[model samples]
Target: VCPEDSNDSSRFMDLWYTFVDPYATEVDEMGTDEANKSVGVLRIKDGRKIIDAYEWKHDNDVHLLAQNDELIIYELHVGDFHEKFKDLTTKIEHFKSLGINASNINSYFFF
Candidate 1:
């Protein structure tokens, strides 16, 4: 549903039905048993296929930036930040509430 190629329509539909749909049921069925988990497979019309599937759990304590050490040193774009947050003051407040340290905000710099 996220604007994939029209050539792989059937594959996309299968992916949506297999993985996206009944996500809760799949997660519940899998539970804490990693070995018993059913991995979703995607088969393209061109014969290329992918088997790995990932689920993002909503954990408020886990920050996206803190997930990987590589992300810590990376600088985020100002325009993207503004577009994502909408308001500067509210964004700053949110960051503070999330225990993010104050850093110099450079909004004028373009990538």
Candidate 2:
């Protein structure tokens, strides 16, 4: 499976490609593999080097603190926590463990 080891068929540089129809139903219309049909990263297989930068990393240091109307509030839909009283109590304790306020996200994920 080594390209450089065997020095097999000669290779040449080719143009990077994408398709108007991503699925590529016709022979003329080329497309990516089914697994790469959606938005994600592309890489060079040899050294696991990333050549495509579709999505960039987010800045983790940014924080926003607002007052009154400027401040955004979040309401969590606590379903499983609402089921058992002990779960709600434990969930509250878990939320308090985090420095900032957190939500109960175990309830519904739509999955």
Candidate 3:
């Protein structure tokens, strides 16, 4: 079940206690009352719930390098590409021949 469907507070609290509470050292020390304020809670009818709470620290500010017009988008299925082209370089060459300046090929799951 997805976390977005939960609407019950108690079920959300239970989920927070079970999944997030175990790993949350900061929240544990703060006690349940105070912890409830800081952490988001959700409840579901089908016995599914989620606690959307975490400390996400970013080392640096995010910078978007690619602009809208500058981006060259290529959408293709990995399985289809693999079945069609046996070699990686050959596929890139084919894209190059078709006037594609830069080919962004996904190396299966890696790239």
Candidate 4:
């Protein structure tokens, strides 16, 4: 359990809970309910059913170029361009030849 000071209720209003159930396909929610009002994360692991706390992990491996203005941006819609990242990876050489250093992709790129 987290220290009371660390889990300060006043600062964190949204109670995040992870429901892990191998047989469950969707979360149950009613907009008015307290659980529904907060965040509910669905998790699939080994083989279990329970509620767990959610933690955020920041990506420290990403390196951005110092010169942002020099970046060559390419807007792409994953769904429209290609269904999956594997298909997009196949065109990496093409993008490199076109000088596309960065891309703005749809939020559902992994979907």
Candidate 5:
């Protein structure tokens, strides 16, 4: 269920993948004494339910970046670079040839 946050319009308002129940199919509106506003569970393009409520833990002992200056990050929009995700996978070799060790995709590509 999307607990609306107190933020301006520029900020993200809708909850993408917050609390999720694998057995449940819809969210119940508990505070709807005047109007009816209930919605079904959110799913991905492949029709699988989304569950991102798990807390992520990172280990710093691995030393992902020994030196910040040594990092070569390449940012790109998947839709703009290629229309399909399978097509983008074919460009991995191309990015490696350009010395791009890390890649970042904008969140807008998912929504």
Candidate 6:
């Protein structure tokens, strides 16, 4: 669809939207209905478009560098570790005793 086809070029915009079609490579959140998703782009290395079919592949796990193996990693759950700074301070000695040189935590959705 084009703006000129709409008969009001100034007010009309040529908008394109994708839906959960059979040709979709993958669906976000596994939505089955058309209105709930957007399709991935299908194209060739030479810029040719794929119109009839799509091949879906699951993402592969990324392999970390060799240096990653050398690091001492201590995984911790921040919310479970402590409720406040004072509480955390009380565990400093315990943490030090663990002899862990590094720590990683994910607390973004802890509510």
Candidate 6 — worst ten consecutive residues by lDDT sum?
Answer: 36-45
Highest lDDT model number: 4
Candidate 6 lDDT over 1-111, as tens digits, reads 345457754673456565555755444554476555555544455676455455556568675543666666677665675556466567767766876555676673666
- In candidate 6, stretches whose alpha carbon ends up further than 4 angstroms from where it belongs are 5-67
Candidate 4 clashes between residue pairs 3 or more apart in a chain or in different chains: none
Query: After best superposition, candidate 1 residue 42: deviation in angstroms?
Result: 64
True-vs-predicted CA distance for residue 2, candidate 3, Å: 25
Off by over 4 Å in 2: 1-74, 102-111
Q: Taking the tens digit of each residue's C-alpha lDDT, what string does model 1 give over 1-111?
A: 435546655443333223433322233344345544555333455675443366666766654444443332323445656555356555666666666654455565556
Better of 4 and 6 by TM-score: 4
Global lDDT of each candidate = 0.48, 0.50, 0.52, 0.66, 0.66, 0.58
Give stretches of model 5 more than 4 Å off.
Answer: 1-66, 108-111
Tens-digit per-residue lDDT, 1-111, candidate 5: 333674454554453433445565557665354343443465465687676586658755475653678879988777876677787789999998998888887654475
Between candidates 2 and 3, which one is better according to lDDT? 3
Q: List the residue pairs that clash in candidate 6.
A: none
Off by over 4 Å in 1: 1-76, 83-86
Each prediction's Cα RMSD? Answer: 17.1, 15.9, 14.8, 13.1, 13.0, 15.7
- How well is each residue in 31-105 modelled by candidate 4, as lDDT tens digits? 585645533446557776555555557666787763787889878876665578788778878998998888887
- Over the full model, what C-alpha lDDT does candidate 4 score relative to the true structure? 0.66
**Poorest 10 consecutive residues by lDDT, candidate 2:** 22-31
> What tens digits encode model 2's per-residue C-alpha lDDT throughout 1-76?
3467667666655665543444322233223775334443334567765444356567676765654555333456
